[model samples]
Target: MAAPILKWKRLTNATGPSPRPRHGHRAVAIKDLMIIFGGGNEGIVDELHVYNTATNQWFIPALKGENPPGCAAYGFVCDGLSKILMFGGMIEYGKYSNELFELNATRWEWKKLKPKPPRNGSPPCPRLGHSFTLAGNKVFLFGGLANESDDPKNNIPKYLNDLYTLEMKVSTNTYAWETPLVGGDLPPPRESHTAVAYCDKNGSNYRLIVYGGMSGCRLGDLWVLDIGAMLWTKPTVFGIPPLPRSLHSSTIIGNKMYVFGGWVPLVMDDVKVAAHEKEWKCTNTLGCLNLDTMKWEHLTMEMVEDSMPRARAGHCAVATHTRLYIWSGRDGYRKAWNNQVCFKDLWFLETEKPVAPSRVQLVRASTNTLEVCWGAVPTAEAYILQLQKYDMPLTPAKTPTGNPPLSPMKATGVFRPAVVG
Candidate 1:
């Protein structure tokens, strides 16, 4: 038990050659790179990797035009700009694709979107294990599975809870689809659930914290979506939360929300000669939900014994300010897998931080010479340290008498940089 601690740190010595095996694939982080796309290995996969978390390396994004045909349960994000979009999935014969692709890492290109009817059709429902998040510039799809004959016995594969909002209209650069101003509390049509987006300091708004999945059965319930006025709140926290799962993996730190692993169902009972042996067990537990004390924490692997990562379920963890970049998925035992085993490793969860020495000082602004910045601590305004103009080089070169880190008092005005050539 004390001997499985691969203390984490193996950023990718395998990305291409391991690009097949999949699981509800779709990763998105625009700046430091992590584009990933599509999934469902032995069948659907127009493939598109891009790891590079600051050069941890893994690249396979040749991007050509008209692409959105190869997929496996889709949904993507990253509107901080470099382009990503992607929508709908399930490709190859039993088809279902509402076509929409963007990708574009500065002309790598993909662009095939055309669902324009009242703005890209109101809300993602071409279905495929749904869940997507990217607030503040909008993009909030949820739930999934609504069509294309998966025939789970006349259920016709329709399990969507419906909640959509795209709204990224940068001067009609396109994307408008709205209608998720739920305002009346919703959360029921589950499909591999998991949605994060916090910041509700006493109702300043923005809180979409759903959890668990599979409404037909496995679900450890917990819901809240209150992006100010567009309501939905159900919080009654108190320790231990993470049981009854679906394709699991949720990440967010700052307002907490870190769930991992999934698949839970053990109904065995072959008593005499009858027949009953349902299965789907993969648990190395680790769930924490503390959107500022909505509590719930059960992190077992014998309590982070070796910094966990064994029981997987459609893997895709994403966080940075430190680490937490789990990739790939599907350890759902004997069911849906493309067999690349252990889901093609690439762990990295390092987080310790107690050492503090962060400073930043730059002031050349008497009225916009533009270099005004200040930081050294955060006695707290919730955190707002703004400083730009770094074409690269921030290791220890921000002099102005160097003790410079004094932001987080909301760091007052002035920030203008939208002149893109």
Candidate 2:
């Protein structure tokens, strides 16, 4: 139903120079813009590229303030509103850094944070491949690989399981570091694990869910940190946990944590090959964990698998109320003599809310402001207003986009909430 050229839409005029294929980059969403920073394709990259998710336009801004060092595999977290906090990362091919920086997305400014040292316990050591997670204004820094030797070429990685918090005073821009005394079954020291913040329906039990990472080798374990009780508990999960993986991307949408694409060993179902015939490789599999029940399930997209991004690792993914966006990572298998592939493409997967709203109504209160209402569902306890402004494809009007091009008005700006009641 569509022209071949239309099916192969490209960003030929992405404004500024296009980014080179890369891996290990960090991406964050600010409204409709995707801000991409430091990753390694050719050494470490420090340049910033912003892509308009709605318009297919790219703008590489010469930011106003000093940027973080050219780095990759660092601890990066966005505080939901505007502030982006980055912690330790690989400054160079084996050189690790422990400095922290904050980027004010509103002003496109950067400020290196000098945390006030804690009265007890040492601050986190230099690390890379760690988790920097945000719950409200406090940023949590967890396990990563720390180096003990100065020799970059011969340095041995020491796995870390330490936890620290950087409390941000948004108004004054001052920060304090704290080492919380945690109890219960502690997670083993590992790096490149996936961790996400979770909060229950009653707004109780803020927990951190940690999954598979590399210790001395790849591991498949799940651990949770109860922030309120300062306790760790390994919840009994249902179904098969994913094959041991690391360097994956995970995000919370509603009450589920969706994880996709990581360094996984060969799988019979994913590759359709015999067990012995398959080797370790990056995978494109998608899975999620229900925070309420602690269950894991592999998922497939509504669209065909061919349309999805290929197997990848070290990519970055972020979610809005109803969509997941993926960008830039290494692909291919891990072998001694094999050459891996890095990509600079961006992709998005649309997902319906677990509980969709019914009898939705909207009124234009003003030219820019709109009022919305919908029938609540019994299972839904939280709601987020997802605003989508349908835009014309950047191609010509006569372009065959598989449907009647903007000849008729299909522009809809409706609110889609993930958790609705």
For this target, which candidate reaches the highest lDDT against the unseen true structure?
A: 2
| lDDT tens digits, residue span 1-421, model 2 | 4311101112334555567777877887777677888887657879888777666688887677768898888987886678788888999766899898989888889988798877697778888999988864577888999888899887788999988988966688688899988999789999999888988787777898888887755667899988989899888899767777888988787888878888876654653343233466788777878778888865544445556677889898877545677877897666321234787677766544346765456644565676777776533448877777665576645556566454222223355666632
* Residue-wise C-alpha lDDT for candidate 1, range 145-259, written one tens digit per residue: 7764655344466688888776766776876667654666677788877787777556366777778788666677888887867787677878866666877878876667777
Model 1, C-alpha of 419: deviation from truth (Å): 56
Give the TM-score (vs. native) of candidate 1.
Answer: 0.29
Rate residue 116 of model 1 by lDDT: 47
Clashing residue pairs in candidate 2 are 376-421, 377-421
lDDT of each: 0.64, 0.75
Query: TM-scores across all candidates?
Result: 0.29, 0.77
Q: Which residue runs of candidate 2 sit more than 4 Å off their true CA positions?
A: 1-17, 170-172, 267-279, 298-305, 335-340, 353-421
lDDT for model 2, please: 0.75
Alpha carbon lDDT of residue 234, candidate 1? 70
